[model samples]
Target: MKKQPIHKIHIFGSVGSGKTTMAKNLSKVTGIPCYEIDNAVWIRNPSVDIRRTDQEIERNLQSIVQTNSWIIEGVHTKDWVNQSWQHADIIVFLNTSYFTRTLRIIKRFIKQKLGFEKANYQPTFRLFLNMFKWNKQFEKVDKVRFLQMTEMYEEKLIIINNRQDLNNWINNL
Candidate 1:
């Protein structure tokens, strides 16, 4: 069966789970604008991230959601982002394995450090180390929260466990 066209898409996952990649690809294929939550959360600083105020972040996100069509991607699943999920026609959760996410995080750090990849934050060793910690924290806390929250939007939620699942979903789209 043909898939319905998606207008508002929200992609959420743990760090290094390829949310940004998938959002970009969906934007390209669907002709929808993509909004990265990092842009709303952090000020552009070459050396370190200076986070925007909570009000500022919410304002930015609200602006994006006010648009007719958009794809929002981020690892953030906090209360502040509940509106985005509520507005979404589809919500994607990239539930990639811990091993895969760890490797991707390492590879991404190297690429960003070498200037081969564009990143939201500086490719500092400190940031790289923190990714591992963040990953673990997400697994222990955020994962359960995501699962629970998704239950409320089960009809719109799509969980991609691996690259094959992601590819198939995109292909169907």
Candidate 2:
């Protein structure tokens, strides 16, 4: 059966590719519960670098699967995430340019500095450096790996390459 992903949507992309924003808007549009995977995986400083225990992560993900509807967004593409690809009805890959991602990261930093967004409690300089590292590594590895890994998978895999006419862009999919 050709399934429609009105329920489980897994959105992945390079940093600052607007996965969170897409999830938020899609959730509003579809009325499906959206879980920011980062929120589940991270607990912030003084708590633990990776928040969930193996069991905890499994349980959390299991609950989402059991619900039969979810939208997970983040950069962590573990083996388990590949398994997530199997069940996902829609897999959205935001293949944005490095320059765009870089600009978005800086803008987000400005938002944090201006008290518009909560500083996820990560140090500014280290986070900035980490983003640079990710930006470089992402362009070189992630997309190629994603294409290879998902070559045979059956899902509505979308590549949002450009930001122009987003609605038209998405509608084409």
Candidate 3:
């Protein structure tokens, strides 16, 4: 099957749910730039560890908004993030299993620390555990919210519960 061309894509899901990985892959396949929300939201407080700040995050997101074409992926999709949906041609909601995503998060942490993931820096276990929060709370609730969000907008929305289905869409959609 011929893959449907994607112009501007937005990937949103629970943490450790492969939002970044899948976004990067889609960007490569479709030739779109992939933007990480972490770059916008995090600041290095050398005195302490790197912490995410709201001001820095808003600024970073504004910079990305200035761009022409890109794929932005994150777990935060509140009103502040409506800008992404405003410009995106396709919005993907990854609903991968909690257990699978948890494993991915753990492996991602190890890989990032070991230089296999090539993250800007390593994240702590607290940050990693936040995935559970997203899975059990935010994403769980947002799953219902996104349906309502889609009703208010006229764009392509894709929801995937498993990786195989997502992979099929990757090649077929």
Model 2: what TM-score? 0.85
Per-residue C-alpha lDDT of model 1 across residues 63-118, encoded as one tens digit per residue: 99988899999888667788899889999999988999999999999898888998
- Candidate 1 segments whose C-alpha is farther than 4 A from its true place: 1-3
Per-residue lDDT for 111-134 in model 3, tens only? 876777766544667767775676
**Weakest 10 consecutive residues of candidate 3 by summed lDDT:** 44-53
> Residue 69 of model 3: what lDDT?
76
By lDDT, is 1 or 2 better? 1
The local distance difference test score of each candidate is 0.89, 0.75, 0.74
Candidate 1 residue 2 C-alpha distance from true site, Å: 7.7
lDDT of 3 at 121: 41
Which residue pairs in model 3 clash with each other? Answer: 4-173
Best by lDDT: 1
Clash totals in order: 0, 0, 1
Off by over 4 Å in 3: 1-5, 44-59
Clashing residue pairs in candidate 1 are none
